[model samples]
Target: MRFFILILLFCCTFKGFSGDFSGTLNGAFTVHILLGTQEKAFNFGVSIFGTSTYKSTSVEGGININISPFFQKYGVYQGNFAGSMEFFGLIGYGKNANLLGSNVGLTRHTAFYDYTKTHNFFYGAGLVAVLNQATGNLKKFQNKQGGLILRFSDKQNSVAFNMVNDVNARPFSKSGTDKGNTARALISYTTIKNDELFGVGIGLDMFTPEADYGVAPHSHINSEEDTRLVLVNTKPYDDLFHLNLFSSFVYQNDDISFDGRFGVDNYKLGALVQNIIHDNFGLYPRFSWPVTQKGRFYSLLDFNVPFNTNFNE
Candidate 1:
């Protein structure tokens, strides 16, 4: 857990920028090894979990978390929530579900799925609810809470479903609720780095949980419609010439479609040009890299802005 946090911090642009410290929707999943001491009794294991960092509109109208498969062989599915009551963080609370896996205990006498051995991968799921209210300013550490949730797991793993929660630092802070209850299912893909190829697959969006910072300062979701789609395309001609494209859509239920994430849909497209690759200017011809029989690490670097944001929405 600590290692993951360090990686997140290292990706930051640093302080003095007045960046958002606390958020309303936040979630994630991670892997865990059983033991690394020896091959005799030790083993390697993975963990899947998620939680909503915040959910409150005015009072925070938070929705459930959205979670899917990630990384390598990791499918996280859990429902949890946390949020502030006064938007500014005068009062806040958080509730997250517990995690379970195969033979999670160190006891040799107890066996997993036998109703013993503490924990295991084949086990079911559990729940844990919490509540906290802050007294002083949000910057100052001051909060408290108390709540309850309905969670259970049996000796035999039967139920197969996962939940995930996210944070909402600012209303509409994360336009992409990849997770959470805002929408049911989503499908997004990328062919090359520094490129835009995003799409969605909706299947279970009951009453998606999205925020509206407020029209006075901001604006709520699309009033007439309740659904929306986003598409992006980026083409960099060397370092100077670059192309960018973006498109969005919204509708009632069915009868709606847009460009796919892994391919072009033809809604938007953009580009930049330089004398040379980075010379800046001109219609220089660009060539493609030949297909190689070997495949290891394939990536394109963008010295201008190496990172693109589209987290667990």
Candidate 2:
């Protein structure tokens, strides 16, 4: 992991000093630390991030640590890649779900490469691996995934497709003999105008007797927060078929920007332990204004609601 980070830093430094380099370099660093006492127990949290970009290539690395008497968690991640004909890899480790009275530690590594000779066409492939270990045992619970992506776009319209296969196994428990193979496919289309964009997408997931789409690996890791979102869905559903449909739109101008999404799906919702599907909707809008040369003020609102009706049943 350190080697990969060093390579990325080296690339950025070399590019900045090269005589033939004509692109610009930009970077940012941020750090936050909080220490206090909650109910007579010590509590503390620390977060640090550093990012740098040269032309079309960028590098980002961050770490988050939270410690308290009742709970403790930490995570580290880094990514480096280019815009087109892209190549990047990410590795992360953190505490995940709890199983059988023991905390599960998750370590994940993801990588991908895309060939985008022209700005309108792209083809790519990606791979992901996740290792789960219990507190006091050396046993392994592993999930592996591979996927293919293709996209085509023009001035006003764009289309993209993705297909992935996932396999998971636990070799040290009573369910050691149980293994699962699942597959999923997603396709989306979008139309763009001067200041407006709209898109719709559908996804189909096929589950085996022991596998569920809710626990499948993501196509890529954009950030630590993205990975956390995926990890939150730990439930297993044996349903043979799962379908999802969604639409989204964005409208922005010099004054304000608005974006919202709505979706209906039969996939499992880990938060709602019920074994049913429903329609979900969300809306987010932001208003911003410049206060000073280097200062800006913004107000944002996010709303989400779920319907009780079983739309997919």
Candidate 3:
């Protein structure tokens, strides 16, 4: 991860100052301090993010890279949006055993219309390709995922909805080529004054591996689903220095074995303070409890900085 991040930073620095785009580079290094029931430590190696945008439309393309040591993630994204339609893609590497395949690499491509006049409805569709870095072949391409985004607002209230789904495929026992299909839906409501917010969502993930697919001997995929509810109150103070009280509940169920079923419940209570002294900065403190496990708590502090502020203009 450190090597990859160094390479990415070198590339960004080169392009931002020397490239023909005549753009600016912006970035920040965050300090992470976490206090939890299981452990308490401070790690400044949390994240490094940088982005650069070119000024000329004739040679228009932008790049972004993010690296996180705590999560063992490195991703680079590049896109061109000179015309009415925008095209972008991302290639990422992660060390999460459960989330990644044996190769630990993933890719995604997206092409969507960029219309500024309309705001009530929008959508994006894309394809995901997963590769095994061990072999470095173009063999594992997953299903196509599509999503719908809706936003509605008036004088008194605002509402938003987002939906996403992926086609199902048979799971791979050894390589884990196709893990499963997924579907997610979310809706949230907020007052125009931004005093309170409420949200609800559900997600389904199903995995099924057939033994006849030349896969190694392994158990079939386990199907799981989760439902979540959230509420937040931000009526304490002014915009710059305000308190947000929030809570959430989640129910999860899964079928991994033929003998029986499994289920669990989770609960969380938290608070967030936004815009301490700069734009897009905040502090989040949370406490989480599980039905059958020990409860834990943590805090997260984040800061965001934009380098090329005139890209959209």
Candidate 4:
């Protein structure tokens, strides 16, 4: 992992200094001092980020290090190919247990590409691989994922579709084999008036947990007993689904410009009229006021209230 990161860093720096290079390098150091009722704490952090672009290709790399009770570090690198393809990688390591109560190390890599002829339509597919290890317990998880995206836009209308799936498993485990999978699909369409002042949009999102299998340690079971915890296979939308319809409008004059969006979902409709709000129905209005040449005040309002509770049959 260290070697890979160094290689990417070298490439980024070499490219930045190469012929006719356009790039930026940034660095920051931060110090934090906290005073509490019982104890005081002090910590510092440093980060270096850089980006380089040669014609249509670009490379970005960054690293962050924090010196606290426990040392923490993270690094990320991404490269774009001719404005149509992308490659990305990230690594993180920490000495202290994270929120999950385990010392974690993570590595991830992803690659994707988009193809378009007239610039009005696009299609792409991507692959992802990840490794997550709990250094405290020597437990590791490997995830393989893939996704597809399609988009089309014209003067008055735009449409988009996306699908993704993930499969996670325990590799080289002595206790027992465990695996789980999930998938999601989404589609959206929007159309605007000829004047481009008002627009309406609709979208649907579907997600499901495909399968799950748990592992049991040998210490928790007898030698003669099976070590598998549980197995489950579920259908799409058995977990959650959402259908949304919304409208947006923009009004502008010489002095000020105003724009906002309001939307409702099937779950929201069921909640207000039928009193059958599903766990998935939480939509909020978003509005913003920007400071214009003649105005000095700016404000914005956007919020959502999400709930997840099972209804009694």
Name the candidate that leads on TM-score: 2
lDDT of 2 by residue, 33-142 (tens): 21111111122323222223334333333222323232111110112110101112221221101000000001110101112211322122222222122121111222
> Distance from true position, residue 118, model 4, in Å?
22
For model 2, state the Cα shift of residue 307 in Å: 29
Q: For each candidate, give its TM-score against the true structure.
A: 0.18, 0.31, 0.27, 0.27
Q: Over the full model, what C-alpha lDDT does candidate 4 score relative to the true structure?
A: 0.27
Model 3 earns a TM-score of 0.27
Instruction: List ranges where model 3 is wrong by over 4 Å.
Output: 1-144, 168-181, 190-212, 215-313
Measured with C-alpha atoms, the lDDT of residue 302 in candidate 4 is: 17
Q: Write the per-residue lDDT of candidate 1 for residues 140-203, one digit (tens) a residue.
A: 1112111111122332222222222222333334323211221112211111112121212211
Candidate 2, run of 10 with poorest lDDT: 96-105
Report the lDDT tens digits of candidate 3 across residue range 37-130. 2113333321122222233221111122222223211011212111011111112211111100110101111101112212222111112222
Cα error, candidate 1, residue 212 (Å): 9.1
Q: Which scores better on lDDT, 1 or 2?
A: 2
**Clashes per model (N, Cα, C within 3 A):** 59, 0, 0, 0
What's the TM for model 4? 0.27
Off by over 4 Å in 2: 1-144, 155-157, 168-182, 206-241, 245-313
Query: Please, what are the lDDT tens digits per residue for candidate 4 over residues 38-152?
Result: 1133334343443344444433333434333212111001111100011222222211000110001011101011121122221222222222221211112222333444444
